[model samples]
Target: MKKEASAKTWNTLRNITLVIILFIFIRYLFDEDPFNDRIGWSVLILFWTFKGLFDAVEDKRSGNKKSMVANIVFVIAGLGILLWQGIQFFLYK
Candidate 1:
C-alpha cells in the first residue's frame, strides 16, 4: 500500500477501537437496564454509520478511491447490524 493509504488505514483502525471502548464503557455504566441497553446499542450503531458516511463523503471529494470504498463498506455493515439489532430490540420491547 502507499504511505498515505497505510496512514489512513491506521487512523481508521484507531478510531474504531476507541469507539468500541467507549461503547463498552457506556454499556457497563448502564448494565442490565433494558431501555438504556437499547439506547446504548442505537447510539453506537448510529455513530459508526454516520462516521462512515462523513468519511466517505470527504474521501470522495478528495478523490481517494480506496478509502472511499472502505468507508462505504463500513456504512453498509453498520446499517446491516443496525437493522438486525433494531428488530430484536423492538420484539423484546
Candidate 2:
C-alpha cells in the first residue's frame, strides 16, 4: 500500500536524522569544552528525545509494534543518559 510505504520512508528518515544528531553530539562532546558546549548538548538531547517520541507515535499509528517498542526504549535510554550526565555535572563538578 502507498500509505504503508510512505510510513516506512518517514520512519527511515527519522532514524537517519536521529543517527546524524547523535553522531554530531558525540563528536562535540569529545572536541569541545563541556562548560561551553552544555547548551548545544542540551538542545541536541532535547531534539533527540522529542524525535524519538514522534517516531514512536508514528510507529504506533502505522501499527508497527516492534518499532514502537524500540522507539520507546531509545527514548528512555536517551533520557536516562541525559539525567545521569546532568547530575554528574551539577553535583560532582
Candidate 3:
C-alpha cells in the first residue's frame, strides 16, 4: 500500500512538471524570430519533451486510471499549446 501511494505521488509530480515544461516551451516558441531565439526555444523543447516523455512513462508504471487521464489531458493540451504557438508565429512570419 505504501509503495502504491508513493507511485501515485511520483506520477502526480511528473504530471505537474510536464505542465510547467509545456508552458515554458510555448512561451519560447512564440518568438518573432525563431532563428534569433533558437536558444530559448531549444531549451523549451528539450525540457518539455523530456519531462513530457518522462511523465508518460511514469503514468504507465503507476497504472492509476484517474491519474492517467489527467496526465493525458495535460500532455495533449501542452502539445496543443506548443503547436498553436508555433503555427501562430509561422503564419505571421
What alpha-carbon RMSD in Å does predicted model 1 have with respect to the real structure? 6.9
User: What ranking emerges by lDDT with the best candidate at the front?
Assistant: 2, 1, 3
RMSD of each: 6.9, 4.9, 7.1
- List, residue by residue over 1-93, the lDDT tens digit for candidate 3: 999898789778877876786676666767676564654665575565556557666667768667666666776766776777678778977
Candidate 2, residue 46: Cα displacement in angstroms equals 2.0
Lowest-sum lDDT 10-residue window in model 2? 31-40
Worst 10 residues of 3 by lDDT: 34-43
Runs of candidate 3 with Cα error greater than 4 angstroms are 1-46
Residues 1-93 of candidate 1 have per-residue lDDT tens digits of 697897798679768875875777487548877667666767677777877887897799789999999999999999989898889878986
Candidate ranking (TM-score, best to worst)? 1, 2, 3
Worst 10-residue lDDT window for candidate 1 reads 20-29
| Top TM-score hit | 1
What is the number of backbone collisions in each predicted candidate, taken in the order shown? 0, 0, 0
- Report, for every candidate in turn, its global Cα lDDT versus the true structure: 0.80, 0.80, 0.68
> Model 2 segments beyond 4 Å from truth?
1-34
1-93 in candidate 2: lDDT tens per residue?
Answer: 998898789878887877777777666767657664774576587677879898789888879999999999999988997888789889977
The better candidate by TM-score, 1 or 2, is 1
